[model samples]
Target: MFSYNVNEEIQLRLLELRHTDELFALTDGNREQLRQWLPWVDGTVDTEHTKRFIQSTLAAFAGNNGIQAGIFYKGNMAGCVGLHGIDWGNRKTSIGYWLGAEYQGHGIMTNACGTLVNYVFSELNLNRVEIRAAEFNTRSRAIPERLGFVQEGKIRQAEWLADRYVDHIVYGMLREDWSMNGQASNRFEVETDE
Candidate 1:
């Protein structure tokens, strides 16, 4: 239900099944690119399946468990990011994202993550956010690092990806850290420059 601009070229909009066709098309177009880091997508996405998934996510959002967004760049579907498996009383949530291969290396994801994290802390009133990435996923890990998230350590054999169990690096950021030092608007200090 929320909408925000990640940058001049990109818009991040909260998602629902009403755009199932759009979701399916984007996911289908980048199946192989996604499979390298995300094994959860089995390359079988279609409009019907996307609708069901979006419905499930919408239900989660209603129950205060999650929010999922479809990333749009210049009016075209570009990728996705989600704050899921929420624990409101604990004031914590996990962040996850995937960009089509075409969208990688453009800093789009870093900007999107920063904006979403800001929204979660300010608008959703969350205290802490966690981001986990497979050990080999440099692109994924960079999002949290560039946002000033603290590296908490790694969980050995934490996630199953590419048909094998892999270690996962966990990163966390508290609301205080973000508000005090991580805001993107402060021209004197950049989050990544630290």
Candidate 2:
């Protein structure tokens, strides 16, 4: 398991099967709001669905393909953030994340993402990290922008929401950019369970 102490108020932990119930409830409660930007909302029917998702992420972790972590706010499961998958040969990865509705505006996701970006560049030694969000979802898109990602372009009708298709705005960050930004104040520690 991988964990990060982003700060005193925000922490991240590997999403495990045991967290299914709470994660499910969090998502379910924020379903309408989340469904607008997330494609998998409709498929997440219950705790069982959450468990399967966690299991797949565990497999991905074991295979060194990806990592999915839960965002814990003040010791409670508040959201999730992760690398959807990494292209080892290219040293690139795409990040995906979502926070509970009530947890928004708390700066949790931003700190969590900053920590993950730090991990990607400093620990994983990856070259590029990408974040894609619906064009209309300003809040989601703002994360990558605030993290100093460059806006690459937009893909028209790139993703389908429940009612319609939405354009996707792509943002990318390079290892070079991170190094010159001065990281002395925002480094995070990664702890793994044996």
Candidate 3:
């Protein structure tokens, strides 16, 4: 298992089968709010769905393609952040994340994202990381903006959220840019279950 301590109050842990119940509860409880920006909320109708999702993430990690980690706040699961998939040939990846409605306004996603960005550059040696958010999702867009990511462009009708199509605003960060911005410092301790 891979776990990272983001701070005294926040931690990131690889999602596992054991987390299915907790994860499902969180999602089920926040269905309406999460459905606003996340398209998968409707698909995840039970713990079984959450289990399958975790299984896939574990497979991705095993293949060195990407990771999906649960964000923990004070020892409780709060949300998730992850790399959609790694393009090893291009040395790049995209990040995706969401938090429970109750976890909003705490800067948890921002810190988790920053930590993941650092890990991408320093540990994975990835040259670039991209984040795409719905054009109207200010909260999601703010994470990359706060982390100094450059606005690359916008994709028209990139995603269909429930009944409507939403444009996506793309943000990208390069390794050189992250280093030059003085964000290379490792602010968290990483632990691997051995």
Q: How well is each residue in 17-119 modelled by candidate 3, as lDDT tens digits?
A: 9999999999999999999999999999989999999999999999999999999999999999999999999999999999998888877888899999998
TM-score of 1: 0.91
Per-model C-alpha RMSD = 2.9, 4.9, 4.8
- The weakest ten consecutive residues by lDDT in model 2 span 185-194
Candidate 1 Cα deviation (angstroms), residue 138 = 0.7
Mind giving the per-residue lDDT tens digits that candidate 1 earns over 1-194? Answer: 67898767778887876778887888888888788778767845567778888888889888878888988878887898889788878999999998887777677788788888888888889899999998988878888887789999999998777788989999999998888894735222222311
- The residue ranges of model 2 lying beyond 4 angstroms of the native Cα positions read 183-194
Write the number of the candidate with greater lDDT, choosing between 1 and 2.
Answer: 2
* Alpha-carbon runs more than 4 Å astray in model 1: 184-194
**Clashing pairs in model 1?**
none
Clashes of 2: 0
TM-score of 3: 0.95
Task: State each model's CA lDDT, in order.
Answer: 0.81, 0.87, 0.91
